[model samples]
Target: MSTTTREAAGRCPRCGAAVHGDGRFVVWCAACDWNVDPAPPDEDRGRPARVRRALARRHGEHLLAETTDGGAPGPRRDPAALAAYAIALLVHGVTVVLAVGGTWFLVTGWGRPLMAVGLFLLALAWTLRPRPHRPPEDGTPILARADAPELYALIDEVAGVVGTRGADLVVVDAGVNASVTTCGVRGRRLLTLGLPLWEILTPQQRIALLGHEFGHYSNGDARHGRVLATAYRSLTTWRYYFAPAPDPSLLDLLVNLLSLPPRAVVHGVLALLDQLTLRATRRAEYLADSAAARAGSTEAAVGLMDRLLVADSAMTTLRREGNAAQVVRRGTEAGDRADGLWERLVADTESIPEGEYERQRRVGALRGHSVDSTHPPTHLRRARLLSATPVPAAVAMTGGRARAIAAELAATRRTVARHIVRHGFPG
Candidate 1:
């Protein structure tokens, strides 16, 4: 059940304006946003800001236009997708050649120094081998059906409604986002639900989130396909191994010079692959959003997108709460802050005004902010969701069942909150 809502608590320290929140949540001025998001924005590591924004704006504008025109492309045999597969196969061919050549060399030069070359080639092949997705071994406990029957049942219901198999495993964590991915050699589905995100969302929004993630499975996301995915991983490994050494010594400089050509070649292939799959990947996301709407209704899906737009702020709020906990506990026996941690987060997020959401929408448009580099811009997603025909939710979240799921998650909520309060979020 959700916490009770309270009225204005105090004045904003920065703006001398009304600060509205329950005491458990941070009191912040909506006018100045003081204490609303204290953490600095995360650094962008993937692409230059200018380039990302440009691409996002272009894609977003084009997609919005297409949505308006009712010409959104459906699943089709994209030449770009086929080209990406071809490139991936070509990349895998290199590994095959190395493996075969190494075997031949070892056989022909059994007792010769050429056997050393064979070992080297074999090692290179191993390094470049296609890697399948694997379940993360991080210490977070996995929630099997036996452990959380209600939660799993809910997920299964949503998956069924969304036309995909239920996740084989579920992980609860401190993040402000959720995702579903195929993991393990057998391609078992895994769903990672961020408690922070879950805490702030309504039950229907949660259903929408799950539907959107599982939608990737039935939607044929180009990025998730085995061939291209493994090829991307292999290329990344190649990049890492061939990357130039920092502050190079003389010998390191010689090695770097030797590796320069292969590094350049690997880089070119990676870029080409990215370009080839870019459109298909973006289209897949929209299709997933459609699935989300189909499962949870357009209103809930739109609400989910709004939640995503403010996710960074949500993270920032959690970080600040964690820091506050640390400060309050200083010089005292370290104690549990987990109990009210979620209540505070829920309050803080709920305290945010509609104006703040509008501000975030504008900021997203100007900066092309998205859930990630791969997703389309949040404003565009919201616009598209709103533009689509509204439908009734296929999966219902009854209060009794919602409470059962919460009860199932009770221990996990505390554990995740305790971790966040102690160490802040992992990068």
Candidate 2:
């Protein structure tokens, strides 16, 4: 319900008078006779039923009930859960083993007392391993200063509909992509948009994009993602330090001969843990997409897909051009002719801004990466949105509008393609 005001006095959109008003809901442009109220009152807004229904459809009714009813489903202490548990166990077990072993070795005069001290230190390090903690900042610095006020507003509106706290907005000076990261004392959530994407998407498309990011945050996808990352890190650490080894050096060989079996057991356990974490991550992505559909407009989800594709295509062209230019500039600087027709083509394309080129490249890269990565492919996601049945009327309206927008976007892509072919992509 709290609103922030813009500093400058502006002419009323309806009447030409200097005025002050809240920027969130109302904007008065005096000279052009423009008074724009972009958002509705807070009390009248709530999470959309369509979003709930879609979530129920994808994740089942019980999931929503669990989140709202405050039922402790307890920890997901399954096999993967066991893996995390095992790490704790191993830490304790190793400490006991070292303490006992060091005492015996010292009593028997088989090794120096320093070995006992060293083992204790190692045990302590394992037991007190630093977990990934959120950064201290409550808000994302990048989102706060990015050029797109409308994008942030849209995200806030959608957050209202889903009954989730809005993420701190962030802007990466990158191109054609968006992602949500959690930072803060407890890993509080943050949403980041690429600058190029802000300049490119229409208002509706932008809302859909924000919806996707919110979907991830609302569904606890970020937490699940972090878990998976942690599991991988744990697995790698165990493998690197504790795995058994055959060593050629006489002293090293003696050490490995003693530790190999236990190390191998630990390695196997961690590998199993890694697999369980990965499965959880993939499931989380699907659930988040469902949440996004439930939180705001299903149409927004679909429109977001279309815009993503458009942005990707644009970026691809830009990257190709950018690389070519880099090669030519280097060749020219070295007094060598830029040879090869393909090389010439690349050089011609490289005149575009580096920021713009990087944006396009990132989009293209996202398409390739999302496949093996946790997030589902964009085309598959779009299909899921379209196939979702028995949609509520409000969601239907939003979806209908979104479809129209997608059609327009498709046409626009074709126009841009033609222009690129003729002009070698705009600068």
| Per-prediction CA RMSD (Å) | 4.8, 19.9
Cα lDDT tens digits, model 2, 1-427, are 1112344456664666776543222334434424322332232121222332233244422333343244212224356555555664564455466556656555665367666665665564454343453432532234342444443545666766544667664534334577776654476666655534643554454665666566655554423445444544444565567544554588778877777787767656544443434444444555555555554456666655655555544465454544444554343422222122223323323332333333333333333322233344455555556666423212222555555544433333333333333334333
> Number of the top candidate by lDDT?
1
Give the Å shift of residue 28 in candidate 2. 52
lDDT of 1 by residue, 298-409 (tens): 8999999988877866887787767766767553522446677888778878876675676666665544643355678778888888876688899989999999999898
List of clashing residue pairs for candidate 1: none
Candidate with the greatest TM-score versus the true structure: 1
Residue 275 accuracy (lDDT) in model 1? 71
- In TM-score terms, candidate 2 sits at 0.48
